[model samples]
Target: MSVAVASASAPARKALWKNLGVQVVIAMILGTLVGLLFPSFAAQLKILGDIFLRLIKTAVAPLVFLCVVVGVVSAGDFKRIGKVGLVAMLYFEIVSSIALGFGLVAGNLLGIGQGMSATTAASGVKPPSAAGAPHSTLEFILNIFPDNFIGAFARGELLQVLVIALIFGAALLHLKESKRLPIERGLNAISDAFFEFIHLIMWVAPIGTFGAVAFAVGSSGTAVLLSLIYLVLSFYAVVIAFIVVVLGGICAMFRINLFSFLAFIKDEIFIVLGTASSESVLPRLLEKLPTYGCSKQSVGLVLPTGYAFNLDGTSIYMSMGILFLAHAYNVPLDFSQQLGILAIMLLTSKGAATVSGGSFVVFAATVAATGVLPLEGLAVLFGVYRFMSIAIATTNVIGNSIATIVTAKICGEFDESVLARTVREEMA
Candidate 1:
């Protein structure tokens, strides 16, 4: 009854034109055409994406806090919540490392950056600075905890906000049911409201995606994309392979059909493609995953934490980006040296989501940490970052969705019947 009721309540049918995914696809086609014909006008449309991002950001902190708090209270066992967290972190570390390895192997095999001459393009294109990134393990740990709770929300620091929510949820566990239940009820209502808020924000998704694609396509000609088109195209191929081979295998092991699971969340995939940011669908996942038979405890505990640590797609980008730079400059990395870089990437990729510019920023920090890769090479790659970002964001959203479902299954928080029901509804 839990998930069946929630999922069954969703409108099972709508006109194709009224569907958000259909609308987004149409907007993307229109936007691409506009970018090709009116580059000048498309450049100005970037504001539409910026505004959408701002509104989405405002909803994230509160939504995450509420979901985690309610999930914790609803589970009725602090020990179980603790177990879910541990399982999620373990899953994140293992899968992310695999993603990094895939990227490194693909770079070596494809030689995507070979014969590239970027010295002229690299100059004057400022590399993203790594100076502000945490220089040590202790510094990184310290940054996760907020000194000012409200300030964390204001600054959109997701890790800090997550820490606050976990502690707040644990504190609620200590309260008696009579007192705690009412608070939980109120939080749940607010969570529903935030879900509604996301639906409203989603209305502007096509507009935002249009502007984003328009800007990306319109401005790409001026960038170094043509010279490095091989890297861009190879990166996409590598990502696709990683998805089908690695993530597909994971789905198979867990008895979840990869195609069906992908179809179930195709809307989220397309939206991420349009906006080129997985954060755009964060709240929507929180609302939808539970209906897909994942418990609230698993969805709430795993998704946000996965955003921080389980960034499988970004993991791939960071390693491949690093290796590609070394190749572009003809900096020969021995087997041992490549392994060392992989080790550094494991740490750097975790920061991808927390950083403002996402994986590109963390990739910069990885380059700085290695000291072998030329930082200027980063600037040349920046020219094509947005092009690669669409695939990265799409992969990430799918990876985290799978992670949540896997976590739910392992923790005994999943319902097979609920999943079957949702699938029927989706197919219908």
Candidate 2:
């Protein structure tokens, strides 16, 4: 009996080791240890993270374009697509503004970043240029339209690709079924192929995550975390509260269990934690959300748009960061001044979705644009940005996923029975 039990357990152990989530967790732990024990060597591992992100990015433009075109064509109604877009934008603005306000309130009440002198903060670090200058509202809007179609995909510009996909998809809607069927089928086949490609790339996630965490820890050193622990803790606290109160409420209103939803997407959540880039899991989300009963149209339209527009996590970071700097530098920001900061962040936060390093760049630009606080103050956050990014990226993914479901429900596109059945299967 003992020999038989051991033989059975061997297969169980092998299967556990084969699980991706288990491997990723192990990679994160080993990466942390390497970073702590061999800082110099670990820093050199940055290339691993860079390569993984580049691979994922290469697929993003084409995947997004194909998904959007297929979604739009399948829905078969331009007016309905327009309505969904309008509602999604409205939802994004309201929720994102609320997140900004929540962050500001949290920062003021907690008094994080206080008692640190601006000179002391700026002592060692050279200030980054206000390289990400705030574009005027008109300029920002105009920039969304790609000057050349191929350039958009070449540059991996999501908003530009979205525009091209929208036009292409709308044009497809006017074609006769005989003419459209073959093209739609072709696009769907290509989109499936891209998803398979994404799966192949994901096999490297453990190595990629290990390098990312190791480089972050190795370069910054753990000592910096002690000095900025309060800011980090406060930011995390705000994120949890937002999820429980804001997103939780939304889930309750939809009669879905927030905990169950979180459990269902736990794999993607872990991936975000490892990669620190929500875009890393875009293809997975596009495939999974439909299984949860959200219409493909809503998932394709709302989820991608939410990435660019919703950005609750980025908004929270921006508001809190500004206040943290203000308090640290002893710069007195009155109600009107803080409001001005909020106003500026509303626009700059949208720009955060444009690229890697975008959140920090936009934060720098917002501070410069408002002139409410000195730009040098941003240097203080350099040590903690990577740590903070993990939280922000994870939150953004959760928020976007929820947004897709909510939008689908509002549009009456969601199938409640299918959602219930999927959740049951997942739990089992």
Candidate 3:
């Protein structure tokens, strides 16, 4: 009996080792050890991460375009699309504002940077210039309308692609079924191909995860974390609170189980943790959210738009980060000033999803716009930024997932029974 049990268990153990999540966890551990042992060699492995990100990015533009177009066309009602967009934007604004306020309140209460000396701010890395500052509100609005249509996809500009897809999809809505069906079929075919490509790219995820984690640890070393550990811990705590109290409440209102929801997407969550890029899992969420009972139309529209406009996690980081800089620099900011920062963040955060290094760029731009916090203070965060980014990316993915489901419920497009059954099967 003992021998037979051992024989049966061997294959189960082998299967567990073959699981992607297990592989990623092992890679992260190995990467961390290698980074600690041989910093220089680990840093050289950064190319592996860069390659993985590049491949993921290659799929982003086409996948987004295809999804948005398909979603809009399938909905078959421009009025409904308009309604979904309005509700989504309104929800994003309210939640994000709450997030910003929560972060500020937490920062004030915790006093995270109170004892930190600004002398260490001189990290020799120059602060980003105001010249390359994020777009002003007017410029951002104008920039959404691409001057050249194809140029948008060629450049992989998300906002631009969104605009084009909206217009193209709406135009298709005006066409007769006979005329539009062929185009829809073609787009669906292309979308499938892109997803397949994503599957192939994902096989390299563990390798990429290893390289990325190793490089981050090797390049920065654990010493950086020790110095800013308080700020890091505080930020993480705020994020957790937001996820539980705020997002959890939202889930409760919709009759969804937050823990079950997390379990349903555990694979994607782990991927985001390893890659530290939310866009890395965008396609997967688009494919899976519908299976969780959100209408495909809602998943397609809300998820992508939420990426751009509904960054609850980023809002928390920006508000808290600004306050931390102010405290470290001994700069006095009254209630009105903090309110001003929140207002600016409302605009700047919208662009966070579309740009590279967006959070930092937006941070710099906000600081410059306010002209209160010292630009040098930005350098103080350099060492711990990568670590913070992992949390930010993970939270962003979770937040967007919830936003899609919530929007679906509000729009009367969700089936709770479908969600319950799907969650049970996935969890089982």
Please give the clash total of every predicted structure, in order. Answer: 0, 0, 0
lDDT value, residue 146 of candidate 3:
87
Error of 1 at 122 (Å): 6.4
Query: In angstroms, what RMSD does candidate 1 have relative to the true structure?
Result: 4.2
lDDT for each residue of candidate 3 in 1-428, tens digit (9 for 90 to 100): 99998887754334777777778888888888988999999999899888988899899888888999999999888888888888988999999899889999999999978878744553555644445445688877886788998888777778888888899999998999999999999999999999899989989989999999899889877667777889999999989999999999999998889998898888888787877888889988888898899998888888988888888888888888898888888999999999998999888888776555767777777777887788777887766777788888888899999988888888888987887788676544
TM-score, candidate 3, is 0.94
- Stretches off by above 4 angstroms in model 3 are 1-14, 127-135
Q: Write the per-residue lDDT of candidate 1 for residues 227-333, one digit (tens) a residue.
A: 77788899999999999999999999998888988888889898998999999999999989988999988899899988888888788888788778888889999
State the lDDT at 417 in candidate 2. Answer: 81
- Model with the higher TM-score, candidate 1 or 2: 1
Stretches of candidate 1 above 4 Å error? 1-13, 118-124
lDDT of candidate 2? 0.86
Best by TM-score: 1
Question: How does each model score on TM-score?
Answer: 0.95, 0.94, 0.94
Model 3 steric clash total: 0
Q: Lowest-lDDT window of 10 residues in candidate 1?
A: 118-127
Error of 2 at 91 (Å): 0.6
Candidate lDDT scores, in order, read 0.86, 0.86, 0.85
